[model samples]
Target chain A: MTEKTLIDARGSFCPGPLMELIAQLKSAEVGDEFEVLSSDKGSANDIPEWVEKAGHELVESREDKGVWHITVKKKR
Target chain B: MRILIIGGGMGGTILANNLARRLSSEIKAGKVNLTMLSASEKHFYQPGLLYLAVGQMMPDELYREQVSLLEPGIAFHVDPVTEFHLDENQVKTQSDRTYDYDVLVIATGSRVNMEEIPGLAENAEMFYTEEGALKMLKSLREFEGGRVVVCVGVPHKCPMAPLEITFMMHDFFKERGILDKVELYYTYPIGRIHSLENVAKWATPEFDQLGIKYETFFNMKEVDGDNKILRSEEGAEVNYDLLVTIPAHKGMEVVESQGLGKDGWVPIDRLRLNMEGRDNVFAIGDTTNLPISKAGSTAHFEAEALGENIASMVKIGQPVRDYDGKVFCFIEAGKDRATYASFDYLNPPDPKPPTRAVHWFKVAYNQLYWASARGLL
Candidate 1:
């Protein structure tokens, strides 16, 4: 099982959540899984799209308590 | 008394609004008349255009009707100025209308000199016009991943625009699965990414993370369109598949022809906003040769001070207000993050300093503009 990291992007807008995720991804090891939580509706959809395009893997995504939780795996 | 304003840009419109509110009260008492002359009918939210160029914003999001922006007390003229008869205290428009003024404000603004570099206007794309933005978008959409060069010509408006474009290009290619195939290069005449030290500190890391190559002290001299190359003043040649260039910016021709401007810009006293050697005449915004950033924030600040100064002159024949050369700018660094920078003659005298808080403030400020423009604030 890979180690898990959590990103709290609640209350942030588009590009904000994405930028935070990118910064975290830079320090994470390959194969590590990170979870991103965002309140911006656009990011709930945009993050997975960015992950897929950037050669990363999207593990899971869900909405709970009005906040979105998305999990991504570092592939490269 | 009659007052005339020569431009309808940020400084002109703000002054017009302030003056209208003040003069309207006086006009009812038969005290004064106000007139505003603008070359264009559309009012552009110029800062928003950078977002538009990056596909984050649409064209309709950046403009308003010119007439609607002006208050009712001021007469609006939609004509370009042909000549400034300064000695006679009159201005002749392209339509041949002559207007005399008890006081004159020259806010004619700057113009893009695309002809300075050979083949650049024809080959490279620009972001100064709506058409140019559309063209650049189309080019980006059809691009198949190659070297993209973003160059800043000397003394251009919005210094961070080239960096913003670079960030967006990085995001664009990354989104298209072509990040590996594309390379982005930023070239400028300055030593760093931005003139403010606070901004450059934050931006240098972002550029490194995005793998965007940058060259400082590189002056763009010419574009060899046929060979797909850009030559700098230092004899270095850079090859590119797509080129985005910000051409040289110059002052309005009317100021040049009337000998009121130096090197294509009107020289105004930084403290008073008054034209050099001329009393009761002022210049503001990008039109004046002020030692300040040519951003909208500076213009707005100048307009506020200028309005009060003019009002003082009207009320007591004394000009009391002073301009502080304060400038605040928001640099968008893609991925929904931006950095903010605020500088004046007193603090961080250098142009490129990095501050992360300023970037967040910029994001907040955009929301503030939306609220303010709609009069919600």
Candidate 2:
């Protein structure tokens, strides 16, 4: 079974969501995917930008009902 | 109507965006022209410099192109204004271009005066600018352990920065397993290291817990670079193996040369934010010699009232509200914990206790600030 960690950073500020993602990514095994839910207007742009800069693969990103659902796959 | 904003730093950009948003109709109808004169094409998120010193943020992440953050309707001019002639209601740029405006907002901000303290520019590393922060970062990486003194030479921007550096250095040394080998010191001009009374009370115990020494009322006078000693005007001396000092800050030379300032600092009516003698010419942020922290947060607050007043003046030839001089700034206490303080002209600083969550909020603020600065937030 594939396990995915979920982080609900909705309503948190800009870097709050990004930092949470980084903190969770630290202990995740290689190939582990994490989905971060954020409501900050800047998170959609900030998270993907940081993920790319940190050499991680962004699996998918979608917005549902004013919330951003960003999924990332841990790539060593 | 022509609105010219000088200095595209924090205050200018925020004011421009707010004005653009408030007067979108007039702007679209070609009834008003709004132009911003910035010294460079880039706007530095200065509060992030402290983060850069500790390697928490990259240099490129702390700045954005000036034009990128402005609305398409606002004109962005990358040039430094050389002269402001209030008598003629005009400004002259270094490129020999002149811009006349019905209203002018001076947000040129402040600059460091390294020469104010002898041997400072020659020896110590600083974190006030991009170059200074990078140099300090390189020096910090090479530091093994020793006496590290963080000194504030004058009323510098971000009153909490020296304390942040002190706390962060202690944390940095601890993480490197050299905390025992390093002696940390924080020096400021006042009895309390911080300008805010409540924050000082909250940080005093933290200083003891972090093993950081606090030296008060020690205003820097000179630096003996060879011996690594800083002499204060109060006759106190601090020795350091590595020193990161905040140099004396002053208003821009252009503002002073134009006789718009006293002792290189522009004095404005705090509540009005208008030049002492000129109503159409206003000043905000570090450019004004206001008795408040020169942090961007204070400028952001001042811009709120100034923007409304400017908008009312542009529309009906009169201001609607008086500025409250409110300010709020977050203090990072290292180790993923931060606190914040809020104050106004009438109220003393009231600080919220430090917490890990607030630290995350500060981090989030750094990222959100870019979009917010562009008026997206």
Candidate 3:
């Protein structure tokens, strides 16, 4: 079974959203999809970079209504 | 459970607020008590002081009442701590109030000691404090132009400040139409322009492009104010018309006087953040002897880690998390473009090229920092 999780890390700064994503990814199964929503611009740029560094797949990233929605697929 | 946090700076405030939110039910149930002891009623956003020196930010824009930023669950006081009794789990304040805590967090932060350099304090302009920044602003405005030497010392609180100010001043001179009159010479104590290698790599070309002259391994030995010359420990010297400096920093006086850690920085478990032998006691941010940048972001992350751990200790049996040595800093490339450094214990920062969008974000973060202290961001 696979699960898609949405982490509303809005109103958090750098490493706040990233830490939350990593925490959630710990329990998430491989191939799980995680979407993080954040208002912080630092996290938006950072999340993609982190995802790439951690060898995860960055599926899609878009901004809407002053919030960024970044989707990632857990690879490990 | 009684938790006492000393120092109302970024780390202490964030930890207190985080605990307030996380342990609210316990606080309401009379199972938890959170108290904060601070040296000042005003929480000055220290980072804004950089812009303040350059006149990009004003003095009024940098402060908030310590009481206002806290959640209702916290008991706040303005009495500065005078002594730490780690054996008895107690602290004595300037007001003669003794506080006992089941858990204690010390975030007393660091201070600039310009006096550490002979003739430097009186001769050079600085931006480490409100008064100093204001003086620098006035000095910058009065100056027609000459060689402006930015001499930096080691272990300053903000890792990027020296570079940030140097780059920002370049634009300031350009805007004032004195770009031709001023020569910018930046000096760093280390072998590289920055303590962080990648940041040094990223800045070298930028410095070249902007014609910002720099000298590495230029540790300040003394300032020959009479001759208007700067001397370095490495046997180098330069003549300057204007001297700006970022002095070496030490952790607060109370920390050192109380035998907490050498030079006021408490030795702590890097991941656990506990005072080496005392688990009930913890240190964060600039107050710790951790070999990392003593910036607000370091404290903020440490606070979050402790917040979770402390709250969990109350709700469960043990701490739930560990601090992973994370720090994020935005480097203002110039007046309008910026880049950032984000890294952890296992990673080294590889700063990307400057972008206008990132600069706007750094601008936004200046205001957002308040919310961050409130543990909202």
Candidate 4:
């Protein structure tokens, strides 16, 4: 079964959003979908880069009212 | 006999590794055992984090696996200490496991107390932890144009960090093309910009050039988040759009509970680092109320003295070695330049001096210290 988790990093800055995502990814099962909510503009672009470089799958990404919603799936 | 060391920070880890290398012969002779207990499994290159905050380095570059840094025959315990039974000469972990030792070294570092001031932890941010630094970096990047206040609370670790943040913020604003719109202000409890006169000599010129306003002898009293104002104990109020504060520091709760720290920190003899009026107990790093700046370099120097003293105690059964209370601080001046100062209370012949060469020396010194501690060189 697949599960989904959301990390609200809206008020956090660059690596904060990415670090939150990583902490969530640690507890997440492979193929589990995790979404990160970040108000940092860099996170919208940087998270995808990290996910790809780390061999994780970026499920989806979007922006709403200055908050970026980025979803990723743990690959391993 | 086993030697137990608590707190695997700069002091504990360096001492453990140095002892392991220097005392291998004794260990082979079935004389001594060494163990280090720590809560975290990562050895942070904390000095580099200052660079990381300004996007100069990545997180991975500032930390390494703790297990990888330990030499053979040294035992590592990844656990938080629950209590210290000084009478029993043992420590109990959170899991109810107890370890007895012939000697105990307390190196548990200081803790940031954000709750000391109202709305500080609620609204203002810090730069001590990795999370805090990352959050601060994010905020600095998103900072477009506004009055940013860098406040230094009373008695904090790395006393120069707030000043460093101000210099970096000045550089950040200049690079973003908003130097004019952004007003930089610093409020500190100290009488001068830096405790050391040598560092103030180098830093004051940079502050003047950058137009960063600072108030010395202004003790931060409270944070009025609703009004965007920080009030000092002297009744002076400074208004700001964004506030970044270095909060007050305190000894670990465990230390306080065990009656180890009085006067806000563990009181140890400056010479031997042994707890006053206690046998077989020693302390190092920020945990001790040493009359010096609580910096990592101080901890590293103390650890060397401690390791040698511990070896002498175990091998020759001699009295502890004397610490000269020596310290050097690397002040990061903007424009990719830094200045260093050397101070030792006992060095009357060559009192504390500052040299331009010390600036470049600090860079090379860090690499040498790290490599030597990790046994890589």
Candidate 5:
């Protein structure tokens, strides 16, 4: 069984949410999944871009109630 | 392990607090010690000065007690550092105390030298400090109309402040019904309006639309207050009734006094952030000679990077990550609109058109910055 880590990165500005996601992904196991909730529109777009460039798997991306939900699975 | 962080400003404070959290167990077990020394008991939010100058915020909102922001398990002090004994891995403070550390982080920050230009300090309006911002507000209130020249110095903190202030001033005068009476002119030391290429491209059209005249390649040579004349190194002179300036900056006094780097900017490895030759000695924020924006986000990101690395070094004997030269800045485009530029070492930022939503976000960020300083946000 794999656990999904949820990070509440709302109210933080650009690069804050992305950084938190990266910090978690750095220590996460290869198959572990982590989701980040960010109110910053810039970081919502940035997290997936970073995930793609970093060779991670973007499992899901959605928006609800002005909050962005981005989930990525560790591939490395 | 003794971690001595000198200068309890944004970089040092964030790094210390972050380390305190990551190494909490080690701290409790007496395996690690975290100490910080700063010059002041108050931690100032520098970005507030811009809003203060524009009357969007007040002075009392910009300060918080430095020790109040720190987490427990980190030893904090207000004694300023006087000397750097890097060879002995120790530092001497003004109160005649010596601190030794296995790892040293130098976040001493930078300072503006307005005196470098003759008549500048005495005559021009500057908003880099609390007093400067208050004085500028008074000057703005007293002035009805004239040629207001906004000249910028190189390597200053907050790369967006020059343009932000210019745009905000336009709105300020407009709201005061003196928009047509004031002739706002801007000057930059570089060929472009901003050091960043993309920002210059974006701001040029905005300046043209706003009726803000500008001259590039204008390095401030001196200010003639008596004659109201401003001279640049390129020899083109600008005549103005009111002079607003951003003075050139240099690293902290101790950094220069100890022969750290040219003009007090200690050279560091871009990724590792270690002072040129020493692995244990690290430099960040405005003090490092990195060709990047000297903004708060730069320091924040660098501190987090250093914190993680230091913690990993204490636990795993090596760093797991590197700083990618990240910087994020919100550009206030006046009239209650703003946009942001976000980029890193390998990527350049593409700032979109200003939006009301982005502007409100910036306004909210002014309040949220407190949480950020506490390493909470």
Candidate 6:
């Protein structure tokens, strides 16, 4: 089942948001997509980079209301 | 214009992000190339390590990859600097790559000199690094209670850490119901408990309340790990079951070997952030002989002026900004409260009381540091 999961890491620092997303991805099915909402500016770049490195598909990444909404799908 | 910054710690990373944002046009136009050379990709939030040692923070919360904090357009290199060719405006890395820059910023910070005092390398557990802190944490958890000595070895990074750890240890033991059994000794090489007058005054009264035996003018000249005793040069000896110390700090070997600082630190114009006799080179953070507290806050404050100074000089051929040497740091006074201290070369704020709100603010600053590193805050 292709489901979307939301992980709000708004107040976390660098690697916190990344670590959260990775943890969620571990329990998430391969077809499931994970969206991370982070206020840290580093997340704008970090999330995408991690997704690519981990062989996950980066669905979309956008900035809204000073928060970064990054979506990634597990590939394996 | 090629701007190369050495050391990817707080100061270098912040400056890189700042330049990339302020000079986006130039960078996009291929007119300015901002590159940062970091020894590794790991960027540790060192302040959080103190909390980690006492089980107040998780291990994962203390660091992130350096590339995670840097923005686009800044070239990040993971190479240790081996030599500085200041005369040629170039630096050589351990990878044997030579980079020549129109302007260079040295932010390599300081290095711990464990060899300074005999037996220090083997005897002491430190909170200065992740591994050291974790070892101390494990030791603290297993041991029931005994004499725990926290020593300020020399002028080291984060001057408040020794005091902060001592305070945290007090709280840790008290919570475990072993406070009465544990004898805490805090020592510094200086004649006083603190360097700043206001900080000393603020912390002096709490010494008795915490049941801490604070000693001054006690320098660690040698350590006897077998007996777990620290010997001072002035014929003073302190016996402890657990020994924690802040080791001696010195500038990077590359900087000293190049004779850039003859004084074992990068010599720079304190206000200008420019290297002495080298207009195209600038030094910031713990790397320079700024005679200021080498805390992340100092680097954060210096980054504002140093970044602008670099941007102006690259665009207009002269720097327009001056650094005021402002430094702000939170001193955690155990029992869940912390105090905020802000000062500069000219002005020092009055000592303020510790509060839970300031402690929360300190945690917020840790979170906010991520954005600040990206120059977003």
Docking class of 1: incorrect
Better of 2 and 3 by TM-score: 3
Estimate, for each residue in B268-311, the C-alpha lDDT of model 4 and write its tens digit. Answer: 88788899888699898889866556778778888889889888
Q: Model 5: clashing residue pairs?
A: none
Could you give the CAPRI-style class of model 2? incorrect
DockQ score of the complex predicted as candidate 6: 0.01
The residue-level lDDT of candidate 2 at B130 comes to 84
What is the docking quality class of candidate 5? incorrect
RMSD of each: 17.7, 20.0, 13.7, 18.7, 14.2, 21.6
Q: Please give the range of 10 consecutive residues that has the lowest summed lDDT in model 1 chain B.
A: B368-377
lDDT of 1 by residue, B143-210 (tens): 99889998776556776687777887888788878989998988865455654445666788878987
Write candidate 6's Cα lDDT for B225-263 as tens digits. Answer: 888889875568889888888876777887878788732
The CA-based lDDT of model 4 is what?
Answer: 0.74
Taking the candidates in order, what DockQ does each have? 0.01, 0.01, 0.02, 0.01, 0.02, 0.01
Clashes of each: 18, 1, 0, 0, 0, 0
- Candidate 5 regions off by >4 Å? A1-76
The TM-score that candidate 6 achieves is: 0.81
Q: For residues B1-377, write the lDDT of model 5, one tens digit per residue.
A: 99999887889889989999999999999999999999999998989999998788999999999999999999998999898999999999999999999999999899987867788999899999999999999999889899999987765778888899899999999999999999999997555687556788899999999999999757677888899999975577999988998777778988988898766888888789999889999998888876667888999999999999999999999998999888889999995999999988767788999999999999999999888988998
Instruction: Please give, for residues B1-377, the per-residue lDDT of candidate 2 as tens digits.
Output: 89999988888999999999988899999988999999989988999999888889998998888888898679998889998888999999989999999989999988887886788888888888888888898998889888998877555677778778888877887888889988988886655656455777889999988788888756667899889999975567888899888766778888878888753567778789988888788899989866567889878877878989988887898899888767788889985889887766656566777899999999999999997788666
User: Residue B79 in model 1: shift from native, Å?
Assistant: 2.5
